[model samples]
Target: MDTTALLWLIGAAGSGKTATGWAVFRELAAAGVRAAFVDGDQVGMAYPAPPGDRDNEHVKARGLGALWAGYRAAGVQCVVAAGGVGTAATVADFAAQVPGAAMTVVELTVDAAERQARLIGRGSADLVEPAAALAAAFDRAPLTEHRVDTGGRTVDEVARLVLDRVGRPAAGAGPWPPRRFPAPEPIAGERVPLLWVCGATGVGKSTVAFPVFLALLAAGERAAYIDLAQVGWARPEAPGDPGGHLLRARNFGALWRSHRAAGSRVLVVSGSGGGPADMRRYLDAVPDCDPLVVRLDARPDVLAERVLMRSKGIGVELPGDELRGLAGADLDRAVAAAQAEAVRLAADGVGAVHLDTSDRSPEQLAAGIHARLVRRGGGAAAP
Candidate 1:
């Protein structure tokens, strides 16, 4: 059988169906899997607004069938879609778009408070009307066999779950290649140490890195926050670029050396430090720096809650069921993954520290990391 699947995520606003589905698309893409994501809301814009009924014929002809057909022709194996699909008929409408396609319909749900909070954060004006309709419809509509609660989970975690159900990221497979960077200039300066802050998704890596960057400067040290996410991945690149990690490492090494030549004293970078190879890839970027790896730690529940709340603020409202998954099974998997990676990192015997931020604030986490870096000559003392 051809390895093809279709995932239709149905849910109301703040249910996290769309974002979670999108995450799945990205995950598959990163794995070099031919996948397509059809956003029902975006596609709906091509046609006029629907009438009073959401399940009417006019609304159902939103070109989803045509879209899926196009994707199938292009050799796309997996199709993921999400939007305001509330009825069984709507699910059938979507399925009809791609004949003989393996389809899975998932209903994502969330608590009222979380939905309201997300609606408010996303600037979803007229929340009361949508909230009431969602509540009534959920109660009246027939539940699907696959229902997910998205209350406190990270998008990555949820995406992983969906992919697992679809049997993706084949065993022993690595992620798609890391993004590429251009060669940086060679510069000379005194050797500076690197404070590497890294952990699983939603462990406050970015949140804590910024504060640590600032703290280093406040302590009268020359420091720069090198966010790996923003570095090589932001720009468009060619397909199947395998030299991304090497280029990114060279670029970081050049950037650090240049900064040091200009009197910069320390390097603070946040990114993949899960294992020896990940750490080596980054450390190789700045060859002269002694590396102080700090792995941020948190329980799965805590990590999921943090990631979901952050997503809401950023305008992605997740469902409570999805959050629950994050807090429960998803969270368990995430914690286990992080623990395994930490153990792998420990084999290096580089005095790496795993700091749990489950009960700590970002400020506290930053301060703790800052103290450690200062002691190691990674940066100046916090003022």
Candidate 2:
């Protein structure tokens, strides 16, 4: 008998694995394939406990075993299953129970601080201990898995990743003889779109990008911020280097993939200039999705002033000599380089939009972008 393909989503509590699993199920169903999902937690809840003993590992094991058996018997060709399968033993059990099944284990990671914040925000303080325990256990688990960070991603975005990895049809055919199935619904949450904001340093890109993010939030859209600059600067081995910036870009792309899989509609990624060659390298490793790439431009004097103001607000104390040495000397050169780079990026199918942010606040710049997005018939825009 042929066994079904099992896609197991493994992660700590609050890691968004369940949400990812649901998204994968929907995408498969939409492609006219038969798929089913079983929540491990729900199955665990139904398992029989020892007499007068609510907690028993043997009982839990039995529950998971039963769940696996049911899926096998039903001949489920595709299964999206999620829970805290954070051990080698559990993974082995799954493999043994489902013979001839292809298993894709998705391991979701989130920064500890962010995971704590999410649990608290959701009023599930009870999750903290279990989440922490799972994190510890995962470190020692001997499972080869595709890892996804869920710190700032939405459910839909993560789901797409899972689908790409595991939801492809077994026979590469349309869904089994169609009966009426409900139209796929987006998992409920705020949509955050990924927006890549690129330009040379001191071009007011972040100034423009942050406000766009805020505007999306104010417009009742959910959004998240990723400052690629800090991501680069934090690199200890390559501090103050351009390669650091490139690494940051690659990391951002990976993180961006997770967010896209979770279903974020708007994501503003800010950093210095990267051309089409850079973009091609990025798309080669990551999935392709069209994002609005806004290139902000400003005069030399305006850029210097903006940089100085930003530095001051952040408490970066610089002596007049050093300040002039760094900011003044680089202003004109940076501005000219950025303008040239923006044109190059435009040639790479980036759909770049140039915004002169010299005289505008971040909010104004973001509003301008919103207008452009609307005018472009909801597709990418070019300037």
Candidate 3:
């Protein structure tokens, strides 16, 4: 008999539990382990009762219990499950169904603001209220043995965390020690990852990009954080608003070459525009580099608060040109600009991943961006 084990990844909607579960299932297979990946949502959908009742605590528990039993009896060594395991009763039901099997639960969490953005991005309507309800319920739910903050982590990274906690069932099957791919050729000429962080003023593009840059550097990858907005303002002789694209391109090229000489392997730039046109202009600057564009966004209220504090030097950080008009006037303009920019980015179809920075601090936001970059295979690519 195979020593079967079960792992339940529990979290609220948009907490990335499902994706992480699938990633774990795939990795376990890659490591020469046979694991069954079960999605509670799919299981519940096997039979419908009340509309939207699939996620009901009792309904999910019943469905998951049966699903686990089938997998266990089939001699599967591992079961990676996600969804609908948000409460103590549901978890207990799973335990009851699979007798003599050691079960581990890993709870994933993210801020409400990010979850809202994710749900909205995926076009999931009528979810805000229910999602909120579930979030509050989970807060009061029983504690799990392992807790992971999936706020800014890639699916692979989160899966790795779960695997580390619960050792693989088929251990020492192959490469007792995992093999690593060789490092890419040293960044030279123009082959490097050019990460562009864009959004309207007061959206924290520079703040987030700088930290991501530092993170890459700390990880031993040569990286540079460039604020194109700052660079544009520094040179007044150039034509066009905030310096023309031609001049900006010239400056960026020189900066890249200099950074390359200094052993930089990645370039992160934050600016105002994040649409297809904006990306094209960046590629014009570094014609040969792979581009990964990220758009940072926040609710109007969040944007207003950040702009107001920064404009007035309320915070310890030095003040800059963020102060456009009178106190309230500047904030209003920023809000409008951010809203309009978001609309434009969506319309332009640049395919940039929209990241919400409403409740996340600069560090958290940066870490999320870095995780996304790594997932996209952006940090370093072999030439």
TM-score leader: 3
Report, for every candidate in turn, its global Cα lDDT versus the true structure.
0.61, 0.56, 0.63
Q: In model 2, which range of ten residues has the least summed lDDT?
A: 315-324
Span of ten consecutive residues with least summed lDDT in model 1: 229-238
Query: How accurate locally is residue 31 in candidate 2, as Cα lDDT from 0 to 100?
Result: 61
Model 2 segments beyond 4 Å from truth?
46-75, 140-142, 171-383
TM-score to true structure, per model: 0.44, 0.41, 0.45
| Best first by TM-score, ranked | 3, 1, 2
lDDT of 1 at 216: 77
Candidate 1, 1-383: lDDT as tens digits: 43457777777787787789878777766666666666555333211223565433323333455345434434455677776676566666666656787877777777787877887777885764676587568768745766677777787887776666556733222233333444343335456777778776566776787788888777777665565543232112224544245434544454444345434567777765435665576676566677787777777667656656654454233222122235556656655565555455445543378888889898989988888877876766876
Clashing pairs in 3: 222-265
Which candidate do you rate higher for lDDT, 1 or 2? 1
